[model samples]
Target: MTLRPIRLLAGAALSLALASCGTTYSMPGIADETNSRASTMFAEAKTAAPRSPISESAGVNRFARVARRIEPVARQLCETELAQGKAVDCDVKLELDREMQQRNAYFTYAEAGNRSPVIRFSVPLLQDTGNDDEVAFIMGHEYGHLIGRHIQKGQQQAIAGALILGVITAAASAQGGGYYDQTAVENSMELGAMVGQRAYSQTYELESDMLGTRISHAAGYDPVKGAQFFARDEAARSGGGQLSFWGTHPPDEKRMAMVLATMEQIQGQQALTRKASQ
Candidate 1:
């Protein structure tokens, strides 16, 4: 579910998968750099997040730890939401690729943009996990996509993404194609096109967090683990939480408060149910 260089590579195909969306943010001379990023992310996902020996690079192994915490929550969301009555299949991975710099994470829905999606974490931006909440939260966020059927929802986002890239491309054409303008086009593609979709994207994120809490709590991981990821005070003003405005994310404190509030709600319901059982 890792995003690739082509998505951000200035030109790629998205007609087949959610991965087909070409990047408007890629500058002319930097396609190779983006490819390196794509390669690195794929390598990391194959090695780190799997349950076996991480034969790939080990620098980003921390994200894999978080991905492990994510599996149960992801499966539960799919089972409950889709009524599949079976384990939800998912692959959660992380990478240090910079092409996905604008995307702290994403739900790459399916092969035909139809099946269960994989969750990609931007390794460049991810903090190493110690308590394991960030992974749970991220998994929850992606599982929320499954609950909300974000693959189908992503069709709408695709239009928004494409349009964003189109406008920037037009702007670049008008500006005589200087390297500076080209770079502007790329940023515009990400910030203008992809960023505008932040409202729904952020909504998906928060919804995932809520659902993740339920899944994690049920599975025995502290639901608060996911929320604590958003508690970093420094990054929140610039970056915290997901599926919201593009200034990075919600304020760290605000996200933590929201997660805690959600937890309390979940706990209250669980307590009520237990009392009734008694």
Candidate 2:
């Protein structure tokens, strides 16, 4: 078999596979004005004094309150936005990770029975939040993951990437008229999986932020203020030195800009609705 044919086939398959994954919803476009404002805000956050962490009890109470409001809004949005006939689980469960020391939150399916979708917030992350809006915004962001079907897409991408790379590696090894190099193909597959899984990572984050803005606003929270949670120059690791929130959700001016742009879109939509009603 010619290496060129195998390479071409692998490339075509890879493109097709990756193209099948990604966001189902459109992301908001960032205007120059919003970008400038986000830059200023990001700069200001760096110099701003750190606020005191809320007491653990206060944080828990705040989380409970925010969850009560955000959960329904998120579920409704998920159900409304998801295409009809899709089987995505809109009933997302909210949980507090009391045992975790890191400041972080994540959305994932439960490992055991039924595999229900769950969003978990660490106690430290809750205490670190500045307000109820921040809590609501973060929760909504996690909900975005579910609505976007990021986890599922990521899994698909990983499999595609691995297969494509493995095929290419095997073909290249065979080009020498030698036995298949299993070790080389396996190593390449592992690398491919990692690369593919992260291919849309940034885009996914922005998509989540965009959806998060709408969800937070519907829950009656200021998303721009809530997004300030990302502006600070805080450690990505927890006090215990484990990777935490900032590690995964790195601080980026573009994210702030995306949130601002999304809010603008939301406001414009609301105004149009009001005018239509009038």
Best by lDDT: 2
**Error at 164, model 1, angstroms:** 16
User: Candidate 1, overall lDDT?
Assistant: 0.49
Compared with the true structure, what per-residue lDDT tens digits does model 2 show for residues 149-234?
A: 89988887887888788888888777878888789989988987887888888889999999899899998999989888777667
What TM-score number comes out for model 1?
0.50
Cα lDDT tens digits, model 1, 121-196, are 6543354333455555655655666666544555645555655575546545655644445565566556544543
The C-alpha TM-scores of every prediction are 0.50, 0.92
- Backbone clashes, each candidate: 9, 0
In model 1, which runs have C-alpha deviations exceeding 4 angstroms?
1-66, 84-103, 110-116, 124-127, 157-199, 234-247, 252-254
C-alpha lDDT of all candidate models, in order: 0.49, 0.85
